[model samples]
Target: MKLFSCPSCDQVVFFENVVCERCNHALGYEPASNAMLALEPTGTAFTSVGRGGDGRQWRYCTNYDHGVCNWVVPGDGAEPFCVACRHNLVVPNLADAANVALWQKMEIAKRRLFYTLLQLNLPLVTRAEDAEGLGFEFLSNDPTSGQHVMTGHDDGLIVIALAEADDAEREKRRTAMGEPYRTLLGHFRHEIGHWYWDRLVRDGGHLDACRAVFGDDTLDYNAALQAHYANGPRPGWQGEYVSTYAGAHPWEDFAETWAHYFHITDTLDTGRAWGFVVNPRVDREDVLTAMINFNVFAPTTTIANISDAWLALAAALNALNRSMGAADPYPFVLSETVLRKLGFIHDLVHGRVN
Candidate 1:
């Protein structure tokens, strides 16, 4: 994500900012312009206050009332929710304060996912637009059954367990699962990978190309997963798969690799925005040097550039965490085979696959 500034006061702001601290102006993000507008109340609607202002009235998304969204829509538009919130098919009951708080956290991560998707200019359709269009369901575990809600994707609907918003509960699960990294944003990116696999690979007629890289996804998924749990990941799986769980099935390999692609590109973009350059003085071979000066989100950007810069940036990030006595923010290695998988995703996203 890139840094944003308040349109009125020019003070640096964040993506989720609802009020600019410097000028005390009400802020709303306009996705079309990808700008944070400082607004002036105009009856039930608002008017942009500065530089990019066009004098057109705008209204905050309906979800903004719940304090979970800060996006704005054209006042004359019929839609109540902004581009991101419109995909939400189900949300936990907001009447309960605890659920509301958790749901807010879920929305924050979900919006960041959408920001990346929009940046890539990927296809986004609501369930109302297509039968298998992208949608979301933030659900809580059934109180009566005491069954936990699984965070997974079905067709185009991505279900996120509200419990994952709780820091202690999520950390406990992460430790139990032996995962090095886990977050609401990570979950969104991973599950959406499944949705895109359906759109870009399965239905987009790239199955043969994908299979060549990810293996035969036609393998029985349930059997593969069952065996994965019964027996551990295949020996020496690290050389080929992004993670042990990715080795369970070709489908999972694709999803895990897909999620990594997002992770790398987005983090690199942030580093680029900050004008970060890594050139460690002690490096003898210059293997740990990078200049993060390119637009990583560009379709024309080569995967080699991304991979090189990511390695440098990730190494520096891990070192910084160690200095603070914290776990590495990125603990996984990108092997040669995994890089090949990422290349496929890069090509697929840019329609470069033949």
Candidate 2:
């Protein structure tokens, strides 16, 4: 989650920016270097290489032709597709004008997912097989398309209907799920949790470790899923669970915690870049300890933690929303359990947690 800048102009840029606002420079993110490069097209728009990024070769994704992306593939790559596009098992029809724009929105979120995954040093290796590879299917989600398709995951691939990318549909599902916070990025994080479980939880090595903190993962997933649907999470679920679904199973708890980890790090790193929080140098144990003590054992820490930060951030975010006449950018509060989960994830990623 370290800040990124436009390589050409040195202007700070977000991962989702398609065109630099400061210089009006065409832009594309290079995953290998984890950068947003200012593009200098060397050929025609459709068949051109952008003059910047790692190895000095970059080309826009084919979906860009359909207006669904502006990201570049490695210019020298024979595949002629961006990393994100390279993983597409299927993309819904773009001829229908609505699908083009909707898919673009999905790409924006997906790219953000890639940014965080890359930033965290998470392994996102893609494979052709059903069980080992990470992949995605952006489908129409139309009943007419077929009875086989559903918004779910199989092996390491996540299948999200293009429907979920729509504002109304996403909101409807969020409400139906009764989740205080839910969004495309959240969905990506949660799904990737399943991806990583498969990635690192083999040989029952992680079974005991995961169970120690999140509870047993050995429960029959199908039966647990059924029980969860039938009974829902226990009352006052937040006392011990990061999210209601987290109480369902160990795999779910891991996923829920995993999502919160992405949320906290990206937000914290972003806050630091914006000069909202003082950042410390590497070994950051002081700031880490401060954040932990403040959030987890507040009575013991003198410095402020996320609770205080959230209060200020919430006010500012709400005011910004009010100024724009839009909904608040951040929609939920973080509970204590969620905080501990984040700490766990932070340590695990840094190899501090075993």
Quote the positional error of residue 266 for candidate 1 in Å: 0.8
Question: Quick one: RMSD of model 1?
Answer: 0.9
**For residues 84-121, what per-residue lDDT tens digits would candidate 2 score against the true structure?**
77678788786788887878888888877776776656
TM-scores of the candidates in the order shown: 0.98, 0.79
**C-alpha lDDT score of every prediction, in listed order:** 0.93, 0.68
Q: What tens digits encode model 1's per-residue C-alpha lDDT throughout 98-160?
A: 998999999999888988898898999999999999999999989899987999998999999
List ranges where model 2 is wrong by over 4 Å.
Answer: 1-13, 21-24, 44-55, 129-131, 145-149, 278-337
Worst 10 residues of 1 by lDDT: 47-56
Model 1 — TM-score against the truth? 0.98
Q: Candidate 1: lDDT over CA atoms?
A: 0.93
- Candidate 1: segments with Cα more than 4 A from true spot: none
Cα RMSD for candidates in order: 0.9, 6.3
Worst 10 residues of 2 by lDDT: 289-298
Clashes of 2: 2
